[model samples]
Target: MNKQKQLSEVTELWKTNKKQYVKKSSFSAYTLLIENHVLPTFGKAFHVEETDVQDFVFRKLESGLSHKTIKDILIVLKMILKFGAKNKWFEYTPFDIQFPTEREKHSLEVLTKSDQKKIMNHIQEHFTFRNLGVYICLSAGMRIGEVCALTWEDVDTDRGVISVSRTIQRIYVIENGIRKTELILDTPKTKNSIREIPISKDLLRLLKPFKKIVNPSFFVLTNDARPTEPRTYRSYYKNLMKELHMPDLKFHGLRHSFATRCIESNCDYKTVSVLLGHSNISTTLNLYVHPNMEQKKKAIEQMFKALR
Candidate 1:
């Protein structure tokens, strides 16, 4: 019988073979999860049974990880085990492991029309360092992290467009028993996510002034010339929403607001999906394609006129 290899060896094989498909940051996350969590728990097992996986998941969830997080961990585990199975390190495939699918019931939270205007009004006049960032999120439909991580090279004022090639996320990294925050620059979450989104002429005019005002290499949105962490900005967003007397919403709610407005303006779901960098049109439809009562009524009237 062939000798079994350590977990690290298996991961290295995946990384080497999967380079074109896997982004560096994703590979890094998988590596970190395996080394810090999965490997330490199952390293010596040489072959993890399906029952072992079920127990690990139960313990992880009980330790307070959210369902989404546990699901992500499971994704890594499955990838590794399947790879191991192909390599013949295990006696049999570990296909019995499964994740419980719970319906995601939290309704998609979006900003009310009045709140959208009020927030825009507040930022337009206030014109702080974050003004450009806020404008991009509201007008360009860029996520807060994507806008914060953008650079001068990505912005083409002449073309009235912004190219989204990369994004930054803050993650917790544990080293030698201590945890610390690290900034990871990753490829956009999906292939379709890599796209060029058109910007309004008015938005371009607003940004032109900031070009000369802020450092070019640094992000368009930052006080100290670094990627602005989303967590800290969410608190600021909460305060702004409170001052506007708006319904409480997270920073991401702005992106949702953008998609909502586009649909209301008769933009097709596919167009909105492309603008938002969704992996596919189906995701956009699933998340934001519900027509409001007024729109439904209008649609029916238009249909009658067409039939007549």
Candidate 2:
């Protein structure tokens, strides 16, 4: 009988094979998941069964991991198992994992229009490089990483667009038993994320003068060669909100606020999806298209009137 290999052994083999095909960011993510979650649970096992995976899911849930995060971990786990099976290191079994039904809908945080306007006004008046980054986010639905990666060359004043092609993130790397963190400047989250969003007139006015003289290679947020990572920027944003006496919304709420305002203005969902660089229109719809009570009543009234 062939000796069954330990899961940890197969995992190292899989990583070596997987690294060549994936982006550095993706490879880093896979490695982190394996090291932090998968290896800890199943490294010593020769094979994992359905019950083992299901129990792991429950434990992850109890530890307050989100459903999406658990699902991502499972995707990595399944790939490792498949890799092991392909190499004849172990027998592979597919598991059916179940999650508790969610009774309450997840509410995304967003800024009220008045509050959004107040913040924008403040940024315009009290302009700083960091404050300008917040203004850009509100005007253009840019993620923190994307904003961090922005440079003067990406801002085209003549075309009135901001080109989004890259993002900056700190990733965990493990090499020869040494773990360290790396800050990477890589392509944005996905292909669709590499897009040009039209610059709003107000933001354009704010940027046009700077475009003339700023170094093309300088990062927009810093106006220097050094780029700010998301962690530092997020902390800056938190303090700005607190100083403004506004609700402590997460930095992502700036994105939600931009999308919500677009929807409220009755912009077409497909256009909003493209501007937001969503991979699919369905994602945009799901996040921003919830009908309010007034809309439901109005819809019913119009339906009855048409029937009559």
Candidate 3:
């Protein structure tokens, strides 16, 4: 059969499988990979060989995709191949793929106690939308996307809780030389991400005054009545810190500060993990559980004292 025939057959099978099980956003991302990258290279590779997959990966690497993004693309491709195989569309597979020995995301970078205090003081007094975003992130340990996606209705002043259920993303899709913008609102990354974080009672009191000024139907941190963009927040916060003569940190560093404060205050690992909406305890441990010499020395000293 010709390349067009093979592409059509695979595409139809993929369309059916996508409809059956995958989330709309997930399936859309997969379809984008197939259309943009995979089809351009492998459209002619009938029953794609393993070398075809390797060459495609290398070509993408040369095109300057990050290791993580490339890895995710490969995962999507693997899913497509598996779907094709399960439905008996292809007797052979394309992916005998392996990854580079690349480093994962940087370990959580948090602030010291004094830095937290400095930032908090500035945000509380010289407030802007960026400060509001920072305050919510620090106090609630909210992800940046969740913070951006939040509507004012999600805050319960009576209960003093912030509900984190939705995430916002800006996606650009290339279709027939037109780049379309898709502003998507979807559930959080994991089941654990759908949680309520209790805000500090003082902050609840502070927010009560703003309640009178806030638009009930709009997103909380928006400059006007639209959803607040994260890049703008990051830029604004950078300027805010400089104006206040404080050290620079990303908007997410506030979240790291929250988790660190909880861990230092003798909160258990599981409690900290849940409060931070981490899917697993290992994430908590990896961030905050490294033992120090001071802690170890105290432990050994206490052991000897107990024996005496």
Candidate 4:
């Protein structure tokens, strides 16, 4: 009979094998989650029972982790467990974890039309390269990292489009009992995230003069070889909001505002999903396409008309 191996042993082996296939950012995420959450609890265990995982979920929830975050941790945990099973180091047992039903309905935060207009108008009136990132995010719904990663070369004024291909983020690295964080430039979040967004005529006019003067390789936000990271850019945005006397909102609120505006303008859900670089239209509909009472009434009326 073979002796069972600790999960930590299998995880180290899995890490070495998995590192080559995944992006650095993804591997870093898995490492962080494993080190912070999984190792302390399950590293020494030769077998992970379903009850143990369920308890871990409850404990994480009690510690104020969101369901999504807990799920991410569990995904990494499952991968390690599966790897252990494949290598004959542990018995395979599928976990069926459950969570208590969440009662509170979460709502997305977005800027009001009036506040959005104020910020846009202010940026247009006092144009700067850093400010251009804010404008592009509002107009094109680019994520902060995507806008931070943008280069002058990505914006084609003649073609009237902004090509999005990459994103920048800081990630944690752990090695030999050492921990450090570093910024990395990598491909977009998903394949769908590599997309082109049309530039508004106003934005094109604002960018035309600079297009001829700036180096094509320079980042759009910095207008230099160096790029401003999302954290630094977020601080700038917060200060701008303060100066404009706008209500406090997270940087991602700009994206929500753009998507909300598109839905309000009667844009088709699929087209809006594509424009926002969503993997599928269902994500767009689930997030942005909630029907109001008026729309529901109209839908019912249309059904009666069809009956007639």
Best by TM-score: 2
Score each candidate by Cα lDDT: 0.75, 0.93, 0.75, 0.92
lDDT of 4 by residue, 231-292 (tens): 99999999988999988999999999999888888998888999999999999988988865
Residue-level lDDT tens digits of model 3 in 70-172: 7777776676666666666654555568756666656566777787777777778877765788878878889888998888788888788888999887655
Model 1 weakest lDDT span, ten residues long: 90-99
Candidate 1 lDDT over 1-308, as tens digits, reads 55676655666576567656866567667767776677778766667677887888788877867777767777887787677668876444545655566565657678778777777777778887666676678887888778767887677877888998888887655556686767887777788878898978767877777666556677666745566777766677777677778887777888998999999888978899999999888989988888766688999999999999
lDDT of candidate 4? 0.92
In model 3, the Cα lDDT at residue 208 comes to 79
TM-scores for all candidates: the values are 0.78, 0.95, 0.78, 0.94
Q: How much is the lDDT of residue 180 in candidate 3?
A: 77
TM-score of 4: 0.94
Q: Name the lDDT value of residue 241 in candidate 1.
A: 71
Off by over 4 Å in 2: 292-308
Worst 10 residues of 2 by lDDT: 290-299
Candidate 2 lDDT over 1-308, as tens digits, reads 45689999999999999999999999999998888899999999998999999999999999999899899999999999998888899889888899999777998898988999999999999999899999999999999999999999999999999999999999999888999999999998689999999999999999999999999999999999999999999999999999999998999999999998888888999999999999999999999998756568989999999999
Q: Of models 1 and 4, which has the larger TM-score?
A: 4
Residue runs of model 1 more than 4 Å from their true location after superposition: 5-21, 35-44, 54-67, 94-104, 171-180, 212-215, 223-225, 292-308
